[model samples]
Target: MRLATGGIMHETHTFSAEPTAIETFDVARGAELWRYAGTNHSVGGVVDACRARRIGLLPTFFATAVSTAAADRATFEAMAGELVAGIAAALPVDGIVLTLHGAMVAEGFPDAEAEVVRRVREVAGPDLPIAVTLDLHANIGQAMVEASTVVVGYDTYPHLDAAERAREAVDLLVATVEGRIRPTMALVKPPLLPVPQAMFTALPPFKTLFERAHALEAAEEALVITIAGGFPYADVPMAGMSVLAVTDADIQRAERIARELADLAWAHRAEMVIRNVPPGEAVAAAIRHPERPVVLVDVGDNIGGGTPGDGTVLLAELLAQGAQDATIFIADAEAVRAAVAAGVGGTVETAVGGKTDDLHGPPVPVRGRVRLLGDGRFVHEGPENAGVPADMGPTAVVRVEGVNLVLTSRKLMPGDLQQLKTVGIDPLRQQILVVKAAVRWRGGYGPITRHAIDVDTPGLGSVDLNRFRFEQLRRPIYPLDAESTW
Candidate 1:
């Protein structure tokens, strides 16, 4: 069976001032993006399942354009044009599978995933089966549902199962292509939940919800059951919790199951709340206990969540306290370039971060000795980002007195331990490790961290989505309006 694969994955924060241009994305074309975009572990398990079943795999093309900026209309159209053109060239295909982030918002288009699917369907001529896998934080819209036959979303928030969801999309596509099943999708958008960190499935109420969803999936009529705790930062009309169910030609069963799951999510909407502690307090808490490695999470400035990864709030606090043996990664291309020009062991003075959006904090000036430098490209050794070759440009490990800082030309999500090792900084030996991310860090840094604290550092990817005025979002979402009942 001939098939085409490609997608644009970005959890765009509508309030972020950073505009995602064509160059903003780490674009991997043709075969080069297979490991980074195609075979992620979250969807890897499904691919293995398909391989075990002896399904013919067609290598049409796979591209990943992940950016941490609010994509403009031009950027969205350009990406869509490239993906559509690529897929059209590989036409006469039996099926297509796309991996989407689900919360993307372009300048004029709120439902960017729908636009992509619409364009692909227009190219494929509607007869070909189209399937997609979405992040758990997908803000799925009616248009997206109308454009595709089958859609599957990640069950885990930290997204440990990205490969598994991709596998499921492939599995459903194979089934549909083989005429074994007619998959119909049913989606219900209730109210919005807080950031993913608060509603993690590894713990309590969420665990119960997942368990129940799993049980529902085991029922004879159900094919796929997914609860998308939507990404609140994207101010789209469909920005809310949704329950999607895929059933074998049974629209009634699909609708019933989806409604049941949506009702469950709505019942627990109040439970999804995030609280952040100041950076100074978090550092003090970490310093008090030297027995375990304390992870300081700079959530607001998380690059993975659509904020510039160049916040100096945490770094400034660490410096003020004269913290020793602490490691922090700052994405400042200027600083890295300056350090590389000065060469290793050379003393350099530069300003880092606070340059992207000064509302978060001002740039901190630092005079440090360049300890190590690299080309800023490395394959991730961690499970969360494994097999993905990341580029941080010309990076340098700078030692400002006793504090070791990682300065990079490219932005990183802080999910790889190899990121530190590549620059001669060991995270395991450090007393405190500051990561610019939300919960995804748990998959990589969980083993090394004695304790992980979610700190409130000011930036675009704020946990409190209400902090920013959202003009495009649908009104009466959760936390923003506690009295509203969806």
Candidate 2:
């Protein structure tokens, strides 16, 4: 059997100020996509699954970028055009495999992933077996469901299971093409917009919830079950939690199982709440917590969910609280340039962070000595997306009072430890560390973090859903409306 592979991935935050331009993406063409084979990303899983089955593989085109604002119309069209063209060119394959994020939004396109599937279907025809793997935080729409043969999502929230999900997608596609099994899928969305902070799958409430899902999957009637804690930042009509069940040619059974899971999630809606402490209180708690290096999660500046990585609210609080031995990353290219000019061991006074937009906070004045400088590139040492290459562009480490400011030229998710070690700061040695992320930061810092506090700062990824007015959302989602019913 042979298969063609390609995809575009992004988690769009509609309220974010940043725009995802085509030029900002990391585009991989043809054989270049194979480089991800050993990584923990979904693309890597595609490569691994194909090799294990000895199936002939043809790589097409893949484009992705870190989470950010919705792509402009032109950007989406250009990328989608290339992806479909590449798949069409790699014709005569037995099947096709696609990796996409479910929460992707573009200008004039609220259901972007569905649009992608429809375009692929136009070229692949009605009978071709097409399989897809998506992020767990997908806001799944019905359009993609009817077009693709099978759709799968990661089981883990920190998304350690991304590659695993892709592998499963490939397996299902191969099985379908060989006539070994006919797959039928059903989707259900619960009207809940829970924050990522409360969605960690390892320990819950969520852990208990996923266990029940596992039980359903183990039953002979179901092939797989997916629980997607939808990306809430995207103000699309489908923005909420979703449950999916895939069965062997049994649509009725799939629908029944999916609805069961969805009902369960709705019943537990109150438990899936975001508990955010004020920035001042969060800093004070971090300072007083006995645990060395308590992780202070700046939910408003969440890089993984697409906020500017330079929110200064926590930094301002740290300064005000007189916290000691703390470390936080900020993205400010001009500040980095200034630090670079100051050279290692040179003192420079400059304003840093909150430069992307006024929503995060204003830049704070700080005089600090530049301790280190680097190109700001590192390999991900992760349970999530492990072995992927991450670049923060030009970087400089500046020590401001008792705080170590690791400034970068680009916005990056704090999902890996090497992102910090590359700048000569050992995270384990710090008393407090600030991560501008929601749930994914746990893949790297959870092991050493003695305690974690979610801070409520005002930016695009804020857990408080009411902060941004939603015009596109399906009316009356929970918390936003207390009377909202499942």
Candidate 3:
């Protein structure tokens, strides 16, 4: 059997003042897509699965990037047109597999992933099966469900299960093509918008829901089940938790299981709330902790959640509170250029961070010595996104008053330790570390740090849903509205 695969992925933060331009996306065409092989990413899983299944794989066009604002109208259209055209050119394939982030929002396309799936459906006639893999943060809608034959979402919130989900998607696609199974799906959305911080799958509440999903799948009651925590940052209409079930030609079973799981999640709605510590208190606590390294999470500037990585609130607090042995990463191209001009071991006097917008915090002036410099390229050595190569453009580290400030020319999510270890800063040697991220940061920092605190810093990615003004979100959602009911 032959299968064609490709899709665009992004987690859009509608509150962000910036528009994701075409220049910001990373594109991979035809043979280039195989570079992801051996990595933990979805693309890598697709390549490996097809090889193991002895299926002919046709690689198309794929473009993705770190979470950010809505895609520019022209940029999204151009990419979407290219993606559909690529799949069209590779016609006569038995099936297709698409990897997408369902929370994506572009200008004129509130349900961007659905739109991409729709376009692909138009290219490929109605009979062919299309299998899709999605992140756990997907805000799934009926359009995505009606367009795709089988939809599979990651079960783990830190998203360690994406590779497994990809393998499952490929397996389902092959089975459908062979006439071994007829996949029927059902989707349910709860009135819940739990923040990512409180949705870690290994813990309670969230864990219970997935455990039930697993039980049903293991018993062969459902072919696949998904419990998405949903991306609350995107102010789209479908911005909430979702439950999906796929069964072997059994739509009734799919609908029954989906509704059952959604009800279970809603029953635990109050526990799904995310509470944050103030920046001042969080910094002080990190310093006082008996642990050698404490992770201070800047909830507002979460890079993985599509906020600017240049948040200065925690950096300023670390300095004002007289905390030492702290390392903070800030995305500022101007600051990096100034440090590069001084060269290694030279002094740099300039303000770092908070350059993109006024929401995060103003830039903090500092005079520090350049401790390290590199081209900012490394493969993730951690459990998450392992074997994936990351590029931060130009990068440099400046040390000021016993605190190391990492400045990068572009916004790179701190989802892996190699991002710092490649630059020569030991992760275990620091007393306090400031990570501009939500839960995904735990994939790297969680295992090493004795304490991880989520700080209520100011920016577009605030943990508090009340901080933003949503124009397109569905009303009467849980936590957002106390009286909201299913």
Candidate 4:
């Protein structure tokens, strides 16, 4: 059997002022796409599954970029055209597999992933079996459900289950190609927009919800169940929580299960909202505790959720409190240039963060000694991107007082311990670690930290959905309306 694979993946934060240019995207095709073979990513899982099934894989074009604002129109066109053309070239395939981020919004394309499926379906005809996998934060839509043969989403929030979910999709694709199961998917979106802060699968509310979904899967009532918390940053009509149920040729059962899961999520809507502590109070509490390390999460500047990594709100509080044995990362190209010029063990004075926009706090002036300079390249030793090489682009470590400020040219979330260990900072020795992220960081740092706190900081990635003005989002959503019903 032969299966063609590849698609475009991106999470668009429409609220971000930063524009996503064509140069920002990473494109790979043909043999180059084989680099994902051993990584804990979507493509990696597809490669392994094909090998195990002895299926001839036709690798095609795949493009992705870090979460950012709406993608450029020309870039979006080029990517979509390339992916569709690849599918056209690799004809006579038994099935297809696509990896997509369902929340992607580009110029002129509100439902980007659905557009990809539509273009492919137009060329491959309606009878082709297509299987797709999406992130847990996908903004599920009816158009997406109707276009693909079957859809599967990551069940875990930190998204450690990327390969696992992709393998499941491949299994379903093989089953359909063998004429075993015909998938009919149903989608249900509740009138709620719960932030990513309260959507950790390991904790309460979400844990129970995912457990219920798993039970349904074990009972064979549903082949796959997805509970997406939804990305609220994109101000679109479909920007909210969604439940998708896929069953074998049973549309009614799929719809009933989806509705049941959606109502259950709506019932616990109040418990899903998380409160935050101010930066000063968070620092004070960390200092008072006897634990060796405490993780202070900066919700507003979450790099994974599409915010600039130069937020200085928490940095200012740490400096003001004269905090000791603390470390934080900032994406500042200017700081890195200055530190590199000063060389190791030399002192450099420069304004370190908040240069991209006025949404995050203003730049805080800091004078620190350059402790180390690195090439800013390391493989993720954590669950998020295990075995994948990350490039921060010209990195340096500056120690201002007792705090070690890691400045990089690229905006990267703190997802792996190797990001710090590559620059000589031991994660186990730090008294306080300020991570500019929400749930994603917990995959790596959660196991080592004694406690983690989310601070109510100010930036584009605010947990409070009311902080930003929405011009296009549909009304009557949770917290925004409070009395909204499904």
Candidate 5:
């Protein structure tokens, strides 16, 4: 059997000020795509699954960029055009597996992933069995469902199971092509908009809801159950929680289960609301807590949610509070360049962070000795993107008083421990670790963290939806509009 694979992956934060230039996307095609084979990303699972099944693989175009603002029309057209053209050239394949981020949005396209699928179907013919694996935060739409045969989403909120979900989708595609089962999927939107902080699979109402979905799957009532919390930053009609259920040639049954799960999420909407503490109070709480190493999550500067990595709100608070052995990372290429010029053991005075805009806070001037310099390339020491090599660009570490400011040239998610270790900072030894992320950092920092606290600063990735202005969202949404209802 011959199978083709690849797609564009991006998590668009429409409210964020960060612009996603075409150069930000990492594109790979043909035999060059094999580089992702052993990584823990979704594409790694596709490569691993095809190899395990002994199927001939046709690698196509794949493009992935970190969370950022919507792509321009020119960039979006180029990416989708290349993806469709690559699949068409592969031709005569038995099946296709696609890796996509469900929350992707472009300048004019609200449902970009669905648009890609539509274009692919137009070229590959309607009979091709196309299976897709999406991020758990995907805002799944009716258009996406109609364009593909099977869609599987990651089960974990920190997205630790990307490979596992990809394998599941590939297996289902194989079965569908072999005439073993016909997959029928149904979707339910429950008028809920929950933030990433509230959707951790290890906690609360989300955990219970996932348990129920898994129970149904174990009982054979559903072949696949995807509970996407949706991306609140994307101001689209489908920017809310969704429940999708797939059954064996049973559309009605899938619809019934999907509606049931959607209702369950609605009932727990209030409980799913995320509350964060102010940076000053959170730092005080972390100091008073009995834990040796507490993680202070800067929600406003969440790199995973498309916020600029240089927010200085929490860092200023940490400095004022006289916190000891605290560490924070700033994505300031200019600051790194300054540090590099000073060289190791040389004291450099430079403004760090908050350079993006006045939203995060003003850049704070600090004088620190340059401790270490690096190329900012390392493999992920993770249960997250394990075995995947990453580049943070030219990096430097500056020690300002009691805090170590690790500066990087690129915005990066704090999903792996090696990001810190590669810069000579031992995360375990620190009393407090301030990270630019929401909940995704738990996959890397959770092990050494004695406790974790979320801080509400001022930026796009704030847990409070009231902080943003939405022009495109449909009327009567939960939390955003108090009178909204299912």
Candidate 6:
């Protein structure tokens, strides 16, 4: 049996000022992406599962056009066209598997995934079994449910199990292709829920929510159950918590299970909302901590959440407070270039950040000693980015007094400890670790951090969801309205 596989993964945060262009995507199709795509240990877990079942493997056509923020309409459409065409050309296939980030929004299209699914369905025909795996932060829409036979979202927020979810989708597709089962999708969109920081599955309420959801999946008819804790930053009509169930054509049962999961998420809405501490307070608390390693999360500047990753507020605060033995990462290409020109030992004075948008904060002028310089190439060793090789683009380690700062030409999310270590910064030994990331950093750094605190600084990735002027979101949402009931 012939099979087709491909992907269009991007989590667009609408508030971000930067527009994702076509060049921003790291597209890998045919054999190149597949060689290292499913070979990583994390991906191996999924590949092994499929191998054990003796399922024939097909070449994957993956085009990952991921920007931290909203993409330009033209760029989004063109990329979608490429992905659809790539899969279509390899068609006359039995089944299809896709890996997608559910929160993507293009310029004109509100439901990007729906459009992709529609295009793929038009080419592959209605009888073909299509299964998709999505990020847990996916703002799953109704059209996504209607276009595909089965949909499964990652259970964890940091998304350590992406490949595993892909395997699950493949398994379901194999079952459908072999005529063993008929998979169908059902969706339930509840009222707005809290952001990622508040909905940690490791904690209470949400932990119980997944537990009960899993218990339901153990029942005879249920194949898979997913609760998408919607990406709140995305200002789309489909923004909110959603429950999806994949069953053996038991539409009624799937609908009932989905509603039950939605109810559970809505019931604990208050507990799931997260509040952030100011930058000054966060740094002060870190200074007071007795533990050697304290991870300070600048949630507002998180690149993973579509922020510009150039916020100088946190760095300015750290410098102002004269924090010693601290490390901070700033995504400023100009600063790195200037430092490189000045040489490793020479000191240079320059204004860094405050370039993306005026709303966050102004740039801070600092005199720093250029320490180490590198080409900025490294393979990501984190659970979230197991096999993906990343580039920091002309990186330099600059020491502003005692605080060591990591400056890069490209926007880099510190997903792994090696991201710091590669530049000669050891987070474990340092007293304070400053990361420009949201909740995803916790997967790698949580174990080493003596204390983890989410700080409210100013940037494009602001957690103040109310600050964003949303024009398309559905009305009467929670938090946006204090007294609204679902």
TM-score of each: 0.94, 0.98, 0.99, 0.99, 0.99, 0.96
The TM-score, computed over Cα atoms with residue i paired to residue i, of candidate 6 is: 0.96
- Tens digits of per-residue lDDT, candidate 6, 1-486, equal 556677788888887777688878877766655544454322343345556766544545555544566777788777778778878777777887767778888878877877888788888888888888888888899889878888888877677777777777777878889899988778888787567676677776668788888888776658999888878888899987888987898989988888888887778878876678999998888877888788888888888777777888888888888888898888789999999999899897898887888865788898899999998888778777675688888998889976888888888777688788889888888989988887778877888888888898876666667878888898888777768886
lDDT for model 5 comes to 0.90
- Per-candidate Cα RMSD to the true structure, in Å, reads 2.1, 1.0, 1.0, 0.9, 1.0, 1.9
Off by over 4 Å in 4: none
Put down candidate 4 lDDT per residue, 34-131, tens digits, no spaces: 88887888888888889888899999998878889988788889888899999989987999999888999988888888888989988889999999
Which wins on lDDT, candidate 1 or candidate 4?
4
Candidate 3 lDDT trough over 10 residues, lowest sum: 156-165
Instruction: Score candidate 2 by TM-score against the native.
Output: 0.98
Local accuracy of candidate 2 as per-residue lDDT tens digits, 1-486: 889999999999898888789977999999999989989999999999999999999999999898988999999999999999999998888999999998999988898988998999999999999998988888988887888989998889899998988999998899899999898999988788888877899977578778888998777768888888888889899887888888999999999998988888888888877768999989999999887989999999999999989999999999999999999999999999999999999998999998889999999999999999999988898988899898899999999999999999998999788888999989888999999998889998888889998888889888888788899988778868878886
lDDT of 3: 0.89
Q: Mark the regions of model 3 whose C-alpha exceeds 4 Å error after superposition.
A: none
Instruction: For candidate 3, write residues 162-271 as lDDT tens digits.
Output: 67789999999999999999999999998899888878888979899989999999999999998889999889998889999999999999999999999999999988
lDDT of 5 at 331: 91
Off by over 4 Å in 6: 39-56
- Candidate 4, 198: how far from true, in Å? 1.3
RMSD value for candidate 1: 2.1
lDDT of 4: 0.89
Off by over 4 Å in 5: none
List, residue by residue over 1-486, the lDDT tens digit for candidate 5: 999998999999997777877799988988978998988889999999889999888999999988998999999999998889899899889998999999999988999999999998898888999999989889999999999999999999788999899999999999999999999999999888888888999997889899999999999999999999999999988888889999999999999999999999988888877788988999988877786789999988888888989999888888898888899999999999999999999998999988987788899898999999999999997789788778899999998898898999998989688898899988888889988888899998887889888898888788889888898887688888867777
